[model samples]
Target: MRLELLYFFFYSMTVYILETNGWPQQGKHELRWNHSYTGINKPSNPIDKEVLEEFYHSTAGPAWLNNAHWLSGDPCESKWYGVGCNPSGDVVELDLSNNLLAGELPDRLSNMKNLEVLILRHNAISGTISPLLFTMKALRVIDLSYNKLSGSFPPQIELPFLTNLSLSNNQLEGYLPNHWNCLNLEVISISSNMLQGVLPNGLSTLSSLKYFDVSENFFIGPFPKEYSSLTSLETMWLFTNRFNNSIIPESWNKLVKMKNFQADSLAGNLPELIGVNWSDLEVLIVVDGHLTGDIPESFCHLKKLKYLHLFRNSLSGPLPKCFCDLPTSSLVSINLSYNQITGTVPDCFDNFRDLRYFYMENNNLTGTLPRSLSACKHLYTIDVSNNYLVGSIPSLYANLKDTLNWFELDNNRLNEIEDGLEDFIVTLSTKFCSLYGNPWSCPLPNYFSGKEYCTARCSSCNTLEQHSSCEKCLTSTSNCGWCADGRNCLEGYTNGPYYPYHCDQSEWVFGNKTNC
Candidate 1:
């Protein structure tokens, strides 16, 4: 019985040895990599190591691709670049962002079953996203933006755990996939793509979605009515798309947390009290649209609002009267240019203490330049041209000489520049301030006479740069003289060491001085 037992055990051991050695017929060194390894801070397990080696080699092997650690070495032990692993040595995150990697994502990527984050953004990667990736339930962030990826997205893709999915600036075409119910998704940026078709209502179903940007797409839309249900949304950008229908303000009633809303070229009327529900709104830009109506008085309720851009619309009526009454207002930039807005320019500058850019150009506004604007020390640019504004310009602004870089007051009915403001005008860089297309008397102040719109009163130069055509009749000589540094000077003036001298030309002529 003892002899039989020993013979049987030896027979079983021989069979085992033969079976293992027979695998070498497939490949010799290949089978050596299948061995199990164990240690603290060791390389990734054999399964993950094999998967990563396939990926690196499959990807375009650039000269800068120095990740030899992921090929044969243990990734956790050698600290493979952009590879993160868990305590048990399982690869969990692979971030190769901005690496200039130039290749399509390999098909075997799904082998990393434990991966949670895959960020390959700003690469030259091309190809359709593998549907296998969406099946990876552990993935939380999948950012493949700024790639050359091209292909229709797979329909009905499901990524249950995804939180941020950014595929912007890719060559991805076709309608967005349908029935996407990623409840944990907080951000979905697919802008700057060729994504066509009406925006799906399934997007609003993402209860945790905070930022959704589909701008610069071919999305035809009667914007999804279910978008009102996106209570968690803080920013929504639907700009530069070819939407068919106008926005319904009531459909956005539940978005109280919304802060930034931009929809350029969208057709809609200014809802009377949009601020009633969007009280937390901060930036609202709806430019180049068919919007019409008075500025909403409810805009005053947005205490945190900073940028209000309603430019190039048909919005009529005076600026909202209540804007000045809002005590907590934080307005800094307000653009309402090229609109049909009527009524005198309102003096709400006192409320916009932080005002930097104020554009009301090409409207039908009629009024004197508001003195309140002079008190806004931060005011840098103001364009109220092409209006019926009468009265002389303000004598001075708080930081007009320094901060005010652009001031456009042309095409108005102004009769004169304020007497004391001539010095300020002379110090200003020419063409930064346009004071023409009005009824200034001929032989205008040398500073203002250089503009082409001032041609009715003076020999003006049409171009802003190199005003060689603006020769002036000097008081000292009946012969025409060249204007340099806002001063009328003889032709040889530039030959002097101090060529373009500060003649205080405008003040000399208009400020009761006699150096003209």
Candidate 2:
């Protein structure tokens, strides 16, 4: 028992030492701190202490995290939570990201003379951006995104050493600070704000700027022309905003390096600006805008467009049949609904073996659904409602029967879709099948209950068509009498809307006054 107690004591001591800041446990040799700062035990600057304490106590601080005093007993120990100090014990990097830090910026943070990186993202840090804080000129990176910080930006405060700046997902409002051109700025995202007014000109002079996203705001008026000078710019996202201006001068084709372009709500039709060497164009979502006219056939020029959504506009004419003709490797979703599109669904759709979602509803496309629809090896959902398509649907489901989900054709002229269509839709009730506007002899599948017939067929047409054995069929061993004169009924199936034959001149219609 005495030996066991001695072993326990040594094990506990080793664990405690390992958990703290120190060197290896190879027979006990304590590690020391190396202060990189110039001086030691200098007089505390009140403002600097306040800022440091604020950072220490903020959500990005270590005090509230784990509640263990990280700076207890000595200052020359291991790395503190969300903090990094040099050998001389001067804070160099403070990353208190995703902490629930609440309150204002403490001015003492500016006193960390050697501090380089300060990341306080995804916290509750509030209040205005301190203008006096930029004096630390050695500060290189600042990421304070996804916080509740409000108020406008201060002007003229320049950080010559700053490289990455992310103030996105905050309550930041008012015009952006001008004249502080961050030439070394590489990534800037001020998205999800109330920022208004014309984007500051000369912004293109920041030649090193790479990722620029000011999307989702109330900014209006004409598109900025100075942006054309950003030759090195790559990803520019201005989607979901009131930037109700035209897509700038015809020279926008010069954005050669742009890849993912999404001006979905930006107004105006697609200019002839396409058909150029936008070789890197991957996603061109100019949909849900004030776009008019038909998609230009020249769209085939974009060999790199993987996802194209030009739906929800006044676009007319036959859908460019060649849209799905591109390489089928990376296509995702294409929504061209709620428009004035006409003409039959192009057979070129057969090439889209990789299509997952294809929506071309609410158009004037006539004729039967193409039989080649069965060839789409990967199609999942199809929306062809409110069109002029007629005829019966083919049994085209040996491929999609297992994978297909929504097959909606509400206002088309379809009735007697083959038995497999009904069975497939009924078996997969939540996912597959719909028919609302056709007039033909179709029965309800047993899986569909509580309703006898689709109201669209029964109410408006005022006719119930059904096939039944007749008294006089071509190959039946039965004799029939056709008293073809007065008070005679029209020839029909033996099992129709009526069992015994009868005739009434008042409501007579369809195939002569047919009686059931």
Candidate 3:
């Protein structure tokens, strides 16, 4: 057959000289307008066009694509910069995101065989990521996130119609690929990578996963007990990693369409009906986790909770006074600082009328301070510092002295401060009141400015003169003029030279100063 037609004409002229741009013959390749796609060449394969001119002449992609518009024309009919083509000329989408495109990352782009979307995000694209790009099976969205890409990560992910897989902040390390079935995966972010081992179970067969982030990465054990049955999981970020798991997998209550669950140092307890299956949870962070019991009163059935971080942890009883009788109208910020919580303080701010940040600082809480929190007219911040509180300081915070900004009642056992809220702490100008270890009385240094009015041991107990020599004497060098069942009369001590002066009339002076 005439030598089989001369070996089929030398294999179609060596595949048409490796598909155009004059195959590796070095130099002399100017094609700016000698252009000719043969009348709009409808090529359904065969126009590798030297795979994007050898990926714009080996990497640095002509400094962000425009080398005179990609060496002039026909990159699938001239529309480049984030190229996308189809109608037979192939090359389906390649968004060079944040296009400051630096070097590396050009494994002939897996020869674009109908490539379906490969966004090089925030490019500065460094090396290592070409495992022939998961053999591109018409890849569906593979974002090389925040590039600076290093090695590892492509052990096996066959990309069967892949759905949004972002190699987050790359520097990607090993582990992870146990074969993510890729069954139409739905959003998988390898967050801040430096990825370590464990986390494989082929990702519980990604049943159409809905946002899964391996946060901050260094991923260690625990987390993949079939990922709480992934019922189309809805946003899960395993924070900071090194996951020394203590427990959070009670089959995660079969994730009833979970809505944002953050984790780091996750320890036990917290599953007490977790708001009856996370009633469409809206941001629940488990901080410094090692969480212990009591916080559940079914979390008042999370009516779409709006940000509730369980601070520090070792949680104890008393904060579920129906959690302010829930229906908190979409509560915003309620951090329970350092736990071991005990009773009182829940006057239920008239059901937190859209309350803003209220942390129960260092718990063991005890009564008085909740004058129904002035019905939270968008209360700013009120931290109950070192608990065991007692009355006064809540003159309805003078209607939240214009959106009160942090009022931390330092070391409690509080005693008097209300001369009707002392002009809400002398006209607040960016409030921050922390009455150090209370015993009150000491606001008159020209009524505020600096330490806001107390502490220097309440300004040396306001130059002493009975207010129990500086608020019911408890060391300012104890003038202890009676009260602890020495039969009252210690409201700011009186009887001329303090002593058995048991002057009770509910003794709480320091302003109208009488009955001593």
Q: TM-score, each model?
A: 0.77, 0.73, 0.35
Candidate 2's C-alpha runs over 4 A off are 1-51, 58-69, 73-76, 85-90, 133-136, 350-353, 370-380, 444-516
Model 2 C-alpha lDDT per residue in residues 129-204, reported as the tens digit of each score: 6665666676767777777877777765477777767777788888876666566877667777778787777566
**Model 1: pairs clashing at backbone N, Cα or C within 3 Å:** 42-77, 43-74
Q: Which run of 10 residues does model 1 get worst, by summed lDDT?
A: 24-33
The whole-model lDDT of each prediction reads 0.67, 0.58, 0.67
Candidate 1, residue 104: lDDT: 73
Candidate 1 or 2, higher TM-score? 1
* Candidate with better lDDT, 2 vs 3: 3
Q: How accurate is candidate 2 locally (lDDT)?
A: 0.58
